[model samples]
Target: MTTGMEELAARMRDFAQAREWEQFHTPKNLAMALAGEVGELIGEFQWLTPAESSSLDEETFDRVRSELADVTAYLVRLADLLGVDLIEATKAKLEENERRYDANLYRGSARKAPH
Candidate 1:
């Protein structure tokens, strides 16, 4: 079964191709937009604590989701345009993170990695 997100991603790709926007969707530009959308997403919880943010009404939560979806949409578009394997990229990054946060040193710890 085709999930909704996958369908949406396909539609977004088709739309981009129809508009010839691929030329403008460079990695740098998409990355900047992703950051901006993330900032907007974070702004929604600017001063809210984990509890407060988590306790928000569904409507507020939906706003956060909307921002997150925007970020994800652009990232998906970039990956499609560049032929990037997002699944592979994500796994590679997580493996890098696991190596950096070695179990012996970071087991159950949440400290930032050394600078």
Candidate 2:
């Protein structure tokens, strides 16, 4: 069954609270942790060529998956701690992006539109 953000956030909160990790779960610390996890996720592709990166072996894929989960967890934790609803924030950002990157103008283009 699929779990909602509230459930996930609650789980993270319980996990942190149980370990008395709230002291370390400040926005600044959580953001830093998220960044570090993202770095680790990127490191999984560090030596691979573009094609190789796209087709990872099982072991490599597993490592990347774990790192990705870490990144997501930390990001959710940070958003929760800051009282931000990530789902709403993401939807709002996508709406903003639609205005900035109109499909008709930006379609199939690699260049970013100047704000």
Candidate 3:
């Protein structure tokens, strides 16, 4: 069956098509731009409280949205390039999480390493 991941990817592709940007989305270029976006995200929180980070002004909001779009675009492109079934991957991760963080140990406990 078709999945949410597939639909989101198709929508992303359609967005690129509408913008005529597919020509510029080479994997290497996208990866480089993705790092830039991540840096921008980190820049927002540098030496700031969670409250301060949450109270971003309009320019910061726009920067965050643009950078988040970059991250999502890069991730979707990578997932597509790798032929990964992301829904399946997500499910697998959840299953692994359940095994690793069993209720007896991690439920309502302090956030510590699994080991």
Candidate 4:
């Protein structure tokens, strides 16, 4: 069963292949692109207060959405290229986090777990 993210990764693979862009899609390049996209996303919220960030106006929200898509595309493509299953990795990370940051111990706190 192909997950939606898997399908999207396939589509991205095809997109790059069709454009002969794979040569430019090295892991380092993709990671940098993903970081740039995240920076763009952050820019959309840079001047907004927490409340304003949460309640973005339509135009700002759309820009944020587009940046998020860019970030996700690079992430998915990078993971696919490296043979990493994003879904499984995310699940495993979530399980690890559940152990590391027990809700009973960390609820409503912003502090990092003790190392």
Model number with the top lDDT: 4
- Which ranges in model 1 have alpha carbons more than 4 Å from their true place? 1-8, 113-115
Q: Tell me the alpha-carbon RMSD of every candidate.
A: 2.7, 2.2, 3.8, 1.7
Q: Quantify all predictions' global Cα lDDT against the true fold.
A: 0.83, 0.90, 0.78, 0.92
Per-candidate total of colliding backbone pairs: 0, 0, 0, 0
| Better structure of 1 and 3 per lDDT | 1
Worst 10 residues of 2 by lDDT: 106-115
> What ordering of candidates by TM-score runs from best to worst?
4, 2, 1, 3
lDDT of 2 by residue, 10-93 (tens): 999999999999999999999999999999999999999999999999999999999988998998888888899898999999
lDDT of 1 at 85: 67
TM-score of each: 0.78, 0.90, 0.65, 0.93
Better of 1 and 2 by lDDT: 2
For model 1 the TM-score comes to 0.78
Report the lDDT of model 2 for residue 65. Answer: 94
Candidates sorted on lDDT, descending: 4, 2, 1, 3
The TM-score, computed over Cα atoms with residue i paired to residue i, of candidate 4 is: 0.93
1-115: candidate 3 lDDT, tens digit per residue: 7676687788877888899988887777777777877887888678778897889889888988887877876777767756777678999998998898877877676666465
Comparison by lDDT, 2 against 4, better one? 4
